[model samples]
Target: MTAAASSAGIRLRDHPAFILFWISRVCSALAFQMLGVVVGWLVYSLTGSAAALGLVGLAQFLPILCLTLLVGHVADTFDRRRIVLACQTLSALTVGALALAEGSGHAGLLPIYAAVVTIGASRAFEAPTMAALLPRLVPGEVLPRALAVASSAMQMATIAGPAVGGFAYIFGPAVPLTLAAVCYGVAAVAMAFIRHVHAPGPRSAMTLETLLSGLAFIRRSPVVLGSISLDLFAVLLGGVTALLPIYAGEILHVGTQGLGALRAAPAVGAVLMSIVLVRRPPTRQVGHVMFAAVAVFGLATVVFSLSSSFLLSLGALFVLGAADNVSVVIRSSLVQLSTPDEMRGRVSAVNSLFVGTSNQLGEFESGMVAALIGAVGAGVVGGVGTLMVVALWTRLFPALFHVDAMPVKVETRR
Candidate 1:
């Protein structure tokens, strides 16, 4: 590592609160990832129906879609630390219940689906609350590096979580679920250790205005709107997650094992890019950097779609992941830094809504498109669409695209 990067790491290590938060985040993320792999495998094994697997994702997402406004309100009104702890505990219990059901031979499709929806609901609460708390744990100047370091949970979860769960599944499906429950438990405990638990400031009652405040806050800020929406439209249009199985099975002709590698490739790229950001956090022209990253994301998708060779496809996925990591780090830092302590939860919930929905919706979009044209054609179309979003977003949210520095903080209007 360069001396400067090494120096940055040491400074970050000085904050004990961030350390605890990071630990909790890693544990929580790992639990979620483990649960995901096992659930998919178990569902597919039980039903052997592709549509059933699709329903599993839909089941998880529906709660988030339904609960977005309420979840954000609760986060803003209550103690974020306790909120996160409670949600993690709930996840542990719900997943544990699923594991017990499996062991007892009562783990039917309905039981699994029920547990997934409950877990999803808890996550909808956990994610935004966690995000709202991060800015409080570190100083404004270091927030970018802090965000980069925190992205490690995503990187670790993306790469290691499934791999660990898959290995544990060799013992039995229940094993991974059991491990996931344990991880959640650990996450809850770690969250409890955070020193400064924020109590939200005095606010208006839970009225229609209060509920819609988050969306309003976002809409008023062109930068926030642009960054968040850019991610939504870009990923919603560009993501090829739903097409991976098809590629592994038919297009790439690599089979299930190949699918595993393909799934991990983007994450691997993300991890590498995150490390670079931690070492040398973006300081200027971040707007340009993010747009470029999104463009690369699009270009890589296009290349991957056109590639016939498996090795070339993997390389394309690697580039795609790396580009995604850059844009995500920049966007996340910008959002948290710009939002106020009081309104962070609400705004973050809206952000979460876009991010959370976009993944599944993107898959759904990709699947629908592929059904009509084919996987390769669908990918190419999605990539081009992402590039078009970049062009249009630059024109629409000029402040974000031309920004030289991310906002340090903003006071929300009540």
Candidate 2:
């Protein structure tokens, strides 16, 4: 498709590949969200230990940090569609096995942990490829809208998934696992029709020299570094996913239903923001907006921490989600537009690493802090830390504050 042809808002209904990818994403996201809740509950239920919950986050993230670089190389070198299909297929089968084990009453801690590790490994490959291929699906001008749509769909799935999963646990965790397997199966099938391909370029020499090249680019690219660092610190500190269960059960005095709402609240807010952004593009002063959103997220987290009422906590979480989506949309679009096509996979891999560290490692941080200082105290302190980081970052990265257009050229060494 010509770039001009794609500049027009291609109705999502008419785009078969996009529709397929969207449905697939929603299904898989729902299943993944459910799987997260089930695993957290299972681990905590089995051991009755906060440390066990932290271990769950560790097992999921450690693999991504270890294997993401290799996966990025593969993404740049191969057809992204095939890579996505293969990863989805393997993940589906893994989830299927989990479902089977659950049905037979054989689901144990070891098996569950093994399954999480396998899924994480598959994600290490899938995420980078998925991120890189997004541009090919739409024109550059329309990329933001497409991303917002995609993000909204995923958030809707997240909002629904955990709620359903939590309710299903009444019957057994098996029911939710079985449903998750179905979602994965459907996603694998939908992924089959994604025709976007990453044509190969001249083979870059494989060495530490080549791998370090991306980092060098990042160092010189203040815009990229600043955007990523903002996310890294803001999410790393303000993140409260690991502590939600404590608030749900203790402070809120609600059961699994409340936990489900807590899990879904952010996504609901994100979806709402995404819908609004589709009509209005983020044009100028995006860096300032991004900073403001991160600060809002921190403030919301603070409110959530102090709130004893379930409804008020949920409202705070919703605001956090909305602000978070704004930051995500801007930072993600900046990264994609600034980085050259040849380096998308590697850059995306690095991006994924930052995201994994912020989220998974953040989970561990929240869990450990909650264990030591209590959930409310830990969350409040984390929020304060995020605000501090934002203040310091703005002062340090002046170029980031001035960024307007995505840079066309980025020099990298082999």
Candidate 3:
């Protein structure tokens, strides 16, 4: 497709490959979100400990932290689609195992943690491989729209998955987990239907140098570094997702249904923001917009921390999600547009590591702090920390702050 043809109003839907890819993404996202809700609720209900909840996050994060570099190399050196299929298959089996264990009334914290670790290992490979596959599905000009569409689909699933999981939990904890396994199974089948082919790049001998190349590239690219690190520290400190169960049960005086609403609220806001971006994609002052969005996100987090009313907290989370979607779109576009195609997998792996840190490790941090300061104090402090991260990052990375447009020329090795 020519650049002009690709730009003529949301032509991503015209591509079969993208459609299949989008379906796979939505299915996987829905399953993952549901799994998160089920796991958080189950573990907390079983153990009644905030630290146990943090440990769950840690279990999921450890594999990604340890294997991401090797996974990045594999993505650049192999068929990304096949890699995704294999990982999804593994994830399906893991979730299925959890469902069986739970259904048998023999589920323990250890078994659940083991299952989470397996899922994390699968995601370690899948995240980078899936990211690398996107460029093959559509032309560069259409990428932004494709990404927005894909994100919207994923967000829509996220908005529904938690509520579904919450209600399904009333049936049995195993019910939601069983459904999550089915979603992963469907995603694997969707992967099988995708026809895009990516020939492996030149294989270099396995070495420390080859594995660390993605990190080196990011360090040299100031814009990518700044954008990623900004997300890293901001979300790392500001994330209060880990404490939601505590808030829903103890503070808000709501049950499982309300917990589902709390989890789904952010995605609702994100879906709305994504739809708006699909209509009018940001083309100028991208950096400024990203900063402002994150600031708003921090502000929303603060509001959520202080609000005792369930409705008010939901509203705060909604605004938080919307602000975050803006930052995600802008940062994702910049990252993809700036990196060389040959190194996209590696760079994307680095991006995944940042995401894992911000999310999983951030969850751990929230739980730890909440254990010390209480959930409300943890949220307030995290929100303030997010705002502080923004100010520090802006002063430190001036290039990121002034970035005006998505640079057409990809950055090359210096």
Residue-wise C-alpha lDDT for candidate 2, range 1-414, written one tens digit per residue: 112123436465446576676777788788888899889998888889877886787888888889877777777777877888888888889988988887898888899899999988888888777888777666677677667777887788777887788888888888888888888888888888777546754677777866766666677788888888889989999999989999999999899878877888898899889877666657678788888889999999999999999999999999999999999988888887777776778888889999988997788799889989999999999999988988998899877766665342332224
Whole-model alpha-carbon lDDT for candidate 1: 0.88
- Top lDDT hit: 1
Better of 1 and 2 by TM-score: 1
State the weakest 10-residue window (summed lDDT) of model 1.
1-10
lDDT of 1 by residue, 241-286 (tens): 8899989998889999999999999998988887888888898999
Give candidate 3's whole-model lDDT: 0.85
TM-score on alpha carbons, each prediction: 0.95, 0.88, 0.88
- Pairs in clash, predicted candidate 2: none
Once fitted onto the true fold, the runs of candidate 1 whose alpha carbons sit more than 4 angstroms away are 1-6, 9-13, 409-414
Among these predictions, the greatest TM-score belongs to 1
> Taking the tens digit of each residue's C-alpha lDDT, what string does model 3 give over 1-414?
223224546454567787778778888888998999899998999999988987887888899999888898898887789999999999999999999999999899888888888998998898778887886777666666667777787788877887788789999999999999999999999999998567777888879998899899899998989988999988999888888999899999999889878988898998888777777777788899999999999999999999899999999999999999989888887887777776878889989999987887788899899999999999999999999988988899999998887664533323
Where does model 2 exceed 4 Å of error?
1-10, 13-15, 41-52, 169-174, 249-256, 370-374, 405-414
